[model samples]
Target chain A: MADASSTAKYEALHNGIEPPSFKLPLIDNPEIVTANTLKLVEQTPDARKRFLFTTLTRYLHDFIKETKPTTEEWHGTLKFLSRAGQLSTPDRQEMELILDIFGAEALIDTINNPPKDSVTERALLGPFFTEHTHDVSNGDSIASEGKGEYMYVDGRVVDTEGKPIANAVVDAWEADDTGHYDLQYDNGVPDCRGRLRTDAEGKFNFRAIVPIAYPLLSDGPLGELLLAMNRHNMRPSHLHIIVDAPGYEKLVTQFYPSEDKWIDSDSVLGVKKSLVVDLEQVNDVESAKALGFQHPERGFKLFKRDIVMRRKVDA
Target chain B: MADASSTAKYEALHNGIEPPSFKLPLIDNPEIVTANTLKLVEQTPDARKRFLFTTLTRYLHDFIKETKPTTEEWHGTLKFLSRAGQLSTPDRQEMELILDIFGAEALIDTINNPPKDSVTERALLGPFFTEHTHDVSNGDSIASEGKGEYMYVDGRVVDTEGKPIANAVVDAWEADDTGHYDLQYDNGVPDCRGRLRTDAEGKFNFRAIVPIAYPLLSDGPLGELLLAMNRHNMRPSHLHIIVDAPGYEKLVTQFYPSEDKWIDSDSVLGVKKSLVVDLEQVNDVESAKALGFQHPERGFKLFKRDIVMRRKVDA
Candidate 1:
């Protein structure tokens, strides 16, 4: 009987009579979604962190809200995402680089590790960082024997107060002259890279050839996107380094050559002025012997700087 | 040789640098993408009639943007789309209803064929609307052949200028009281719906059982989403009509029952106040005689509505 009455109503409406309409109960405000996000944040238990979480969540929401793609475009996106997964391997860690390129790496890094104070500077862990490396002597060359120009990088690790941190660890790595890593070498020789723990006076030094500016991997879809934008895909001449100590913070940073053309256009955007220093030429025999150079005619270079790290509370 | 020299130059720089670094560029003042219907107008060459096209494009984009589904949510979307395609058939056109639910049907009707400035209004071509239908006489009943409520829908097709549109083609269709169309019936009976052209004085009348406000097919992924949202999948009671004439403009619109509860929460946001009517009930021997009703004691209802179609050139 109920069904029959409903049937009659449908007939009355479908045959000719019009249906009624109503409007949604929404406020006349500009920030509708922001208000909603704030409401959602209130659902969380932690009151102190609610504002930060809401900010991040709302930012992400706004990011996706604008770049709305169709179902077909979504299919293309999924295909691209699957390829990202397929490209990840032990030898070539492209996933980390992808995260860096998309700014997710920076975002996560900012949240996971903030600066100790307003004066301290936070750093990023770049893609080329590896877990382990062969430790070399202070004066011994870390480069392939007789490969390129001899570089003497001497540095002392210090606290924020400028006091030398005895036994600080400065692990460094750099590509060979051909822009190839030690692992990428087919001949089973590790490239010019090593880990050298600072001495008793917080002093650390290594001898290696400087690395030339090289283009990032430019065969992927990201590379195509860069090419379309007419942007160069090269990082300027640089050396990767990580300084660590018990009482101070670990600083993951890079040193870029001042004259490299690609310095202004480093694709990964990793360059700092404080990290730049000149390696003065040494033609004198006495000076060469002090730095352990055999041939007096064979010119060598001397570089000296200090690594400063922020001191953490617990450390 | 060029590569080798460049490599040497980099080495010389590396040997010369103390600890190379520079100020990192900040990614401040980030811009969020804001695309809407206007984007299509800007990108497309044919900007004159971009209204409907951009509406459709923005509709899809907004749906995807508002529902920021994770990768896992896409599977449900794919399944729902697959079922939408599966629901389509040659004789039974469920695809049209799917389009109606998506507002595509009304959009196409509004764009392709507009109502005349002085003629009667038309409704959308619904899923139950089959091409082949036997035109009945003034007193003929469509419910005599189908199973539904005993209803008599009588109305005249009039112009927007308060004049009767004589001999206008009025195509009509509606589901049974159970909200099921004739095609949903197991037996192959197509007489449940029919077409009746308005008479010379712009008077048109037809007899059919009332259709119930029924829930749409809710077994698919869209259904699941509806259920998750705690929303019923039913639409308000409504009728479909298509008024087409040579001198007058074509109008396609739905007539909705004024008392329909679902009007407040229409799934597709289709119901409009201008389309609703009271659908008055009446019971008299004289009325039965004039309308050719067999059972005067059973009573009948009157639904009167005038469709206003826009003129050709002005529209």
Candidate 2:
């Protein structure tokens, strides 16, 4: 009855009824079977699935060929997108974070950026990459909150030929006294994160804040995927680094603190054997002062290291 | 400065802050990495995909454990989910459609739904399951509107045992003169959709409609994925059916109207050789009336079919 009335009304309005505006556009295409799906051609794997994927893939292309978004749906998509920007902070690059968690970040970088020839593996741009580093001296403390371990770290940046790459920027940052990134400190002291440029001889050093293993944020769709995997989210002690040179491919990598247990199990597959370094203690005051420490007698740990990179042209 | 003020306020008003309130419970029995993931493990033809599947499954678990959502985020997720339901229609099961395009629906139905012993392959629940079909004589006409070839289709539904399955329902619906489903016929006249029950002797008949080939909806995320995969979305001429019996598993299948130009290339991979039936014309009236048609010379076609099903225990 409703159909009949609606038909009559439509006829009265327009000389003839027309298709509802929502119908999909017409398309014609062929199906291609791939090695990945050939075995499921019959029996156990279920042939319908193979056919469905093959057919649906074509349908999807046609849809894209004729993309149509309603004004309201388009606006809703835009509005939802705006919230992603609002959610970002120094400790929270929610947009990039979302991409990372969903695997798109890894996929795009892997496909388009393939670790430039011989540069150190490029890690993800995590939420904590701020512009400046606190200028702590050779033995100055970074654990101002007075919590966590009290160890030291040191390293150098170099090129493929093992020569020290002078003046390379070796910015570093990490969670602080309470295992929370500076921006997440929410309490205002962005003291836990910092950066440092390597010296003329390609050496860089810092003191205070022995790093401890900590878990990733335990919330959101990403968190849910991780928990379902039964894997631990703890990251081993590590120092973030961004090495850049005018004519060399830049490298963003991390040095895992040797004692932290999760180095071998970094969830994002960020840890590498060459990126692990040891922090040894030195009780010599004169030696500390030579390294620019005000407290010569103050105990300090030392990290000595070098990094290699491929020439930019080759990369 | 703001940090200092907030610190002072915190000390004066609430003493030192306690630990953060958002701690996630860690697992006591963490899963041991029993096997190296980089090596060949599953020997199946799709070993690579299988490995990826397992790896992602585990990773998702871990992600969930670490990212426990705050109450607000949880509520936001709920609200986001409600939109999926609001988007559904009789012609389109949005959620099921998503599941189909994502392979989740087939995976769930194929691997999870049926008992281990069934021989019939489980297929996906398509978007066009809404239209109600009706009973029409073999020589009857179904051309209410739109355009296509004038075809007279005849076929039988049989079980593995080859016995007739009496009174099985053969509900059918398809596109009219235009390549659109009844749901897409929002303008008027619920034309090309109907339901028809078979006679006690496993015989059923219908007339009038000869459907044109059509394209599936190609807009949305599913469409985008298809574009990335490079495929099209066209279904060949076919009759939809839902064959049911008291003790047998319900069969929702389609029979191709023999000779679709692209029968071999249905994007959805739904063309089965066994399901194709030829359409014949009957110019004689006595033979048409013997089969119970009111007219003969007026140019009607005769179609005879039997439906068969497997016995309860065997089925």
Best by lDDT: 1
Candidate 1 yields a Cα-based lDDT of: 0.54
Against the reference, the lDDT scores of all candidates come to: 0.54, 0.48
Candidate 2 lDDT by residue in tens digits, B1-315: 235433322110111212222322211112212122111112113543344434543443333333433434433433333333334445444443433333332222322333233233333345666644445543344445223444444555556665556666666666654566655545644555555555554555555466667655555443433343444445576666677777777876666656566465454454444455565666776765554444444554433444445446662
- My TM-score estimates for the predictions, one after another, are 0.47, 0.60
Which ten residues in a row are the worst by lDDT in model 2 chain A? A9-18
Task: Give the per-residue lDDT of model 1 (tens digit) for A81-103.
Answer: 33443444443334444433333
Identify the candidate with maximal DockQ. 1
TM-score: model 1 vs. ground truth: 0.47
Interface root-mean-square deviation, candidate 1: 15.7
The runs of at least 3 residues in candidate 1 whose Cα sits more than 4 Å from the true structure, single-residue gaps closed, are: A1-122, A293-298, B1-315
**What is the CAPRI rating of model 2's predicted complex?**
incorrect
Residue A81 accuracy (lDDT) in model 1: 37
Please tell me what DockQ candidate 1 reaches: 0.06
Query: Per-residue lDDT for A34-99 in model 2, tens only?
Result: 211222222113343345444433333323223332334333433333344344444444444433
